[model samples]
Target: MTDTALDMSVETGAASYGAASVKDYVALLKPRVMSLVVFSGLAGLIVAPGHLHPVLAAVAILCIAIGAGAAGAINMWYDRDIDAIMARTQKRPLPQGRMDPDEALAFGVFLSVASVVLMGLAVNWVAAALLGLANAFYVFVYTMWLKRRTPQNIVIGGAAGAFPPMIGWAAVTGDVSLASIILFALIFFWTPPHFWALAIFRKVDYSAAGVPMLPVVAGEAETKRQMLWYTLALFPIGVAPYFVGVGGPVYLAGSIILGGLFVLSAIRVLRSEDHKPAKQMFTYSILYLFLMFALLIGERLAA
Candidate 1:
C-alpha cells in the first residue's frame, strides 16, 4: 500500500492489460457522480428565467455530463496508483489492470476538449468556459494539487463540482446571476460534510492510499466537528433561494425538512463513534441534495 508498492504494481499493470470493453471506459467516467452533476445542472436550467430550445437544452446537459466524465476519467488515471490500494477503488479498470492509464488519460483529454468545443458551438460560450474551467479545476487543482497535499482538499476542490449548476444557468441566461451563484454555494458548502462522512468510515482506505483526507490527516474528532460546522452552514445555503424570492413555499418547506434531517444525521455523526452513524450520514447526504434540487425544480414547474 505504500508508494513504492503502488509503483511496482502500476508498472506490472501497465505491462499486461486485458481486452477491456466499452463498459470499462464508461466506468472510468464515474457515471454515478456525473449523474448527480447532470441532474443538478438540469435543475438550474429549469429554474432559470430564460428558455432554451429543447435540442439545445439537451445538448447543454450532454456537454455538462461529458465534461464531468472527462474530469473523472483524468482523476481516475492520476489516482490509479493509490486507487489500487483502496478497497472501494481496487476494482477500477486502471487498478485492476484491465485498462491502460495512458489510454484513460487520452480518452479524458479527448472528451474534455470535445465537450467544451461542442458546448460553445451549440450553446453559449459562457457555459463552455465554465465547463472548461470545471474540468481544469478538477483535474489540475483538485486531483493533482490538493488530493495528496491537504486535509482541507475537499473544501477548496469542491468549487469544481459546484460549477455545474452555474454552467447550466449560464447556458440559458448567457450570464451568471445571484440565483445561480446561490445554487453554486449550496453545493460548495455541502461537499465537506458529505465527503467527510465517507472518510470517517474509510479512514483505513485513505491511510493505506496515503491520501490526506480529513479523517486521515485531522483525526476523527476534528473531522466530525468540522462536519457539523459545514452541515450547519449548508442548511442556510440550501434554503437561501427561498428567502431571495427565487424558490417558493414548496421549495422552502422541502429544503427545511431535508436540511433538518441532514443536520440530524450530522449530529449523529458528531455524537457517535459507531460506523453506523457515519454510514447513515453519507446516505442521507446524497438524498438531501437530490431532494433539495428536486424541490426547486418541482416548484419551478408548478409556477
Candidate 2:
C-alpha cells in the first residue's frame, strides 16, 4: 500500500476504536519483546561487578521492561499506518481498531517518563538515563525516522535493544564500563542477522507496508550476504566476555558452541532456496541470544 493510502486507513481506523481490554493494553506493550529485553537486562545485572539490594535490582529490571514496553507502544502507534497494511502487524490493537492512537501515545509517554523517574529514584541515574535514551532512540530514531527510510534501520536501531544489558550493568556499578559496553556490542551485532532473517521471509509484508527493510529493498541475496557478515562478526563478539574476564570456562565453551550454531544458521539461510531456513534462522537467533546471556548469568551466579 502507498503511504497516502496507509495514512487514510489509519485515520479511518483511529476514528472507530472500540473499548480496549486489559489484554489489549498488555498487547500494546509487546510482551514477547519485553521478555527478552528483561532477560538480557537481568543477565547484565547478574554479571556486573557489584551488589545491589534485591529490591533495587527488581526495580531496575522493572524500569527496563517498562521503558522497553513504552517504546514498543509508541512504535506501534507511529507505525499503525503501515502496520494496518502488513500481514504480521494487521492484528495489532491500533490496526484492528481496538484502541485509540492518541491513548496509545499517551500511555507510552506516561510509561516512558515513569520508568525513567522511578529508575533514577530507586536505582541510579546512569541506568535511568540510558533507559530514557533507549526509549527515545527506538521511538524517534528507529520507528519515526530510519525504518521507512533506510535499509540500515536494524543495524543502527539495534543499539536501542542493546541498551538493556548496559543499563543493568550501570544499575549495579553506577557507571558504564568496558564490560557493559561489550555486552552492548554483543546484542548490537546480533540484531541485524536476527532481524534480517525475519525480513527475508517476510519481504512481501515489508514491501507492501512501504518499509525499506534490507530484503525488501536489496533482495534476499544481498540481505543474506549481510546476515552472514553480521553473524561472522558476532561470533567473536559473543565470546569476548570470556577473554574480558566477565565469563568463565563454561561460558566460554557454551558461547563458542552457540556462536558456531548461529553462524551455521546464517550460512543455511544464505544457501537455501526456500524460506524455511530463514525462518529457522530467525527462531534460532532468539535462542542463541537467550543462551548466550543465560550462560553469562548462570556462570556469574555460580561464582
Provide the lDDT at 193 for model 2.
Answer: 95
Residues 135-231, candidate 1: write the lDDT tens digits: 9999999999999999989999999999988999999999999989999999999999999999999999999999999998879999999999999
For residue 22, model 2's alpha carbon misses the true position, in angstroms, by: 0.6
TM-score for candidate 2, please give it.
0.95
What value of lDDT does candidate 2 attain over all alpha carbons? 0.94
Backbone collisions counted per model: 0, 0
Could you tell me which 10 consecutive residues in candidate 1 have the lowest summed lDDT? Answer: 10-19
**What is the Å distance of residue 100 in model 2 from its true position?**
1.0
Model 2: per-residue Cα lDDT over 1-303, one tens digit each: 798986887677643565688998999999999999999999999999889999999999999999999999999999999999999999998998889899999999999999999999999999999999999999999998899899999999999999999999999999999989999999999999999999988899999888999998889999999999999999999889999899999999999999999999889889999999999999999999999999999888888
Alpha carbon deviation, residue 12, candidate 1 (Å): 7.5
